[model samples]
Target: MRVFDAKLKLQSQLRLMRSENNTIGMVPTMGALHEGHLALVRQALSENDVVVVSIFINPTQFNNPEDLNKYPRSMEQDSKLLSELSEELLIFAPGIREMYPESVESVSYNFDGIEEVMEGKHRPGHFDGVATIVEALLRAVSPDRAYFGEKDYQQLQIVRKLVSQKQLPIEIMGCPIVREPSGLAMSSRNERLPKRLRKEASFIYKTLQAAKVKFGTESAIEVSDWVDNEFNIHPDLELEYFEIADAETLRPIRRKQKENKYRAFIAVYAEGIRLIDNIALN
Candidate 1:
């Protein structure tokens, strides 16, 4: 596998591939490779002639400076992990200056109301950072398709909206959420969890599952309350926010709509590390 830290050189190579009619797939990441990340790259490799995995920990995406500092960075380890998957893979590991030559601030975007709820509500400018880095990466790579994990269902929806509004000719593919055997959703942040808390973190998914079961006989608000209560009783996990919202609009609903699909989104703090997960209801 070859790594390109320079955007110009990477784009120049991609242009050659374009001339040869090679379909390019992109898997954008923030380093600290995990199975979940590898899963995206695997899907990209299967479908596209060439896959470009960009591993730049975007500073613009972190609203909290501490979270940004604590975020994992293991390029050598990440590169080795990718190499085991495919030698044909291209790695775009650019420096902060390379990604943002002028300023490092996130550019604001109006992703309808999709950017104003759940994560958006909690993290303030988090989605703006997400939109900014994703737009920059999309522009830099210009791949035929880009892959994202469904674990971040909200971000997935917002990215689709961003592409539609921008009229970008690229397919945004949402892969399934990879989980541990205990059902904890795989996240780069999972690394920060204490050993015991890591096991306790499975409760987060269990609560989501129970909430799903309750949704059939209970109201959205009722199910949400149950989820809240479950976390309240848990010793290690603290619930940040749990909402059953329209899967498309991501607006929390009071009652389930017969015409609309619903999903339960939850965020919990295991110690100081934040972990998030979501499940479809009906």
Candidate 2:
């Protein structure tokens, strides 16, 4: 596999592929390669003539300075993992300055009201940072399709909106949420969890499952309360926010509408390493 840190060189290489009418697929990620990320890459490889995986830990996305400082980086290890998948894969691991030559600041985006709840409500300016980096990468690679995992379902929705609003000629594909055998949603932050807490983290998914079951018979508020109680009793996991919202609009709802799909979104702190997950209620 070839790695390019310079955006100009990467664009030049991709331009040649475009000239040959070779379809390109992109998998944008922060470095800390895991099976979940590889799953996206595998899907891209199956459908596209060429695939580009951009591994730049975007600084603008993190609202908390400490979280940004503590975020993991393992370029050497990440490169090894990608090489195992395919030698033809193009790896774009750009430095911060390369990505943001002028300054490391995010461009503001409206995202309609999609940016007003759940993650958006909690992490201020987070999606703007996400939109900024994603737009930059999408422009740089000029891929026909870009793949994103649905684990960050809100972000996925926002990205769809961003592309729609910007009229970018790219398909934003949302892949399924990959999980461990224990049901814990796969996240780079999972690496920071202590061994004991790692096992305990499975409860986060279990709670979501139970909440889903309850949604069948109970009210949204009732299920929300149950989720809150579950985490309140747990010693290791602390509930941050739980909302059952319309899957498409992402507005928290008290009653499920007959025509609208719904999902249960939960965020929790597993000993200070924040993990978020969601499950479809209908």
What C-alpha lDDT values do all the predictions have?
0.93, 0.93
C-alpha RMSD values across all candidates: 0.7, 0.8
Error of 1 at 80 (Å): 0.6
Among all windows of ten consecutive residues in candidate 2, which has the lowest summed lDDT?
Answer: 251-260
Q: Show the colliding residue pairs in model 1.
A: none
Question: Where does candidate 2 stray beyond 4 Å?
Answer: none
How much lDDT does candidate 1 score?
A: 0.93
**TM-score against native, each model:** 0.99, 0.98
Report the lDDT tens digits of candidate 2 across residue range 176-208: 999999999999999999999999999989999
**Residue 242, candidate 2: C-alpha displacement in angstroms:** 0.5
TM-score of model 2 vs. true structure: 0.98
